[model samples]
Target: MQNIGKIVVVAAATLSLAACGQGAKTQAAAPAGPPVPPSSAAPAPQSKGRECAADDIKTTGKFGEKPTITIPDDCDPPKKLITKDLSEGTGNGAKAGQKLQMNYHLVTWSNKQVLDSSFDSKPFELNLGAGEVIPGWDQGLAGIKQGGRRLLIIPPDLAYGQGGRGIEPNETLVFVTDAVSVPAG
Candidate 1:
């Protein structure tokens, strides 16, 4: 009976961790002009495959607002994690162990569909490098300054290895994150 209880606890913990990504959706085409409103439909698939690099992924919009992320159709996944600062922030840089409050937009590279976002609701909070989130977030977010906006291109190993609840297996991830606050440490 005690062993069964322990198994249940472990299963519950695993489920909670895998809940990071909500669901799977296909990629879409990029919007032409201003950022697309939240009500816009998903983009259509394109033929060209863009290399997995910061230069190829386009982000538009001011910091602290919901930005537009346009991933090339059939984007080749990177072998490792890539972090690029779209806008630099002042003050101390973020390090492991410090708590961070942030708003982010996440999309899967394979389908270019939005997997999750904190812009419409409350900001997401996490302790850096504490295994509270995916390995990509832990490895990619280090040294980002408060108030800065960054782009993280994460391959499968850094994200969900075998995939999770809603994420497809071995799917690459693209994120646009704004550091809402990271207390001085």
Candidate 2:
């Protein structure tokens, strides 16, 4: 019985030492430097745009139906023109290759909170005819005269599609925009 007890203790000790050695080897083999920060390993920034949150979207109506949009009172009203009515743009005013400057605020249709804007100081410029922006911008900005302010309710199909870049997928976008300038031909 004494010998058997001694053998059990020896086996336990050997197993413990083996575990300890492996643990030490693992510790030694691990990188000695400080842990890398998560930010350092993050994916590179993409320029498509930020995505919207899923909670920000609301599609109660049937597909292909344009949602109703209400412009806030603080939004500047559309202007009137003598030679041309600037209130509602002609929808054919802008052509490809022409640069346009405009102040815009984008919000979610469900909450009406401003998700993005370029209206703080200077207006944002874009080639109207080019396909540089979302389809809504290209189609919505077409034919709109300069100095006009319009409200555009862009559906997901026109705005971001299923997965909106930088925002949520299939989100409807609302924009109040003032067309500040349009380059002449």
Task: Please list the residue runs of candidate 2 whose C-alpha ends up more than 4 Å from where it truly belongs after superposition.
Answer: 1-92
Q: Could you say which candidate leads in lDDT?
A: 1
Clashing pairs in 1: 26-111, 27-111, 27-112, 28-43, 29-43
lDDT for each residue of candidate 2 in 20-42, tens digit (9 for 90 to 100): 99999999889976444477564
TM-score of each: 0.72, 0.51
**Candidate 1: where is the Cα deviation over 4 Å?**
1-50
Alpha carbon lDDT of each predicted model: 0.85, 0.60
**lDDT per residue (tens digit) for residues 91-127 in model 1:** 8999999999989999988778898999999889999
Q: Which whole-number lDDT from 0 to 100 does residue 163 have in model 2? A: 53
Provide C-alpha RMSD values for all models, in order.
17.0, 14.1
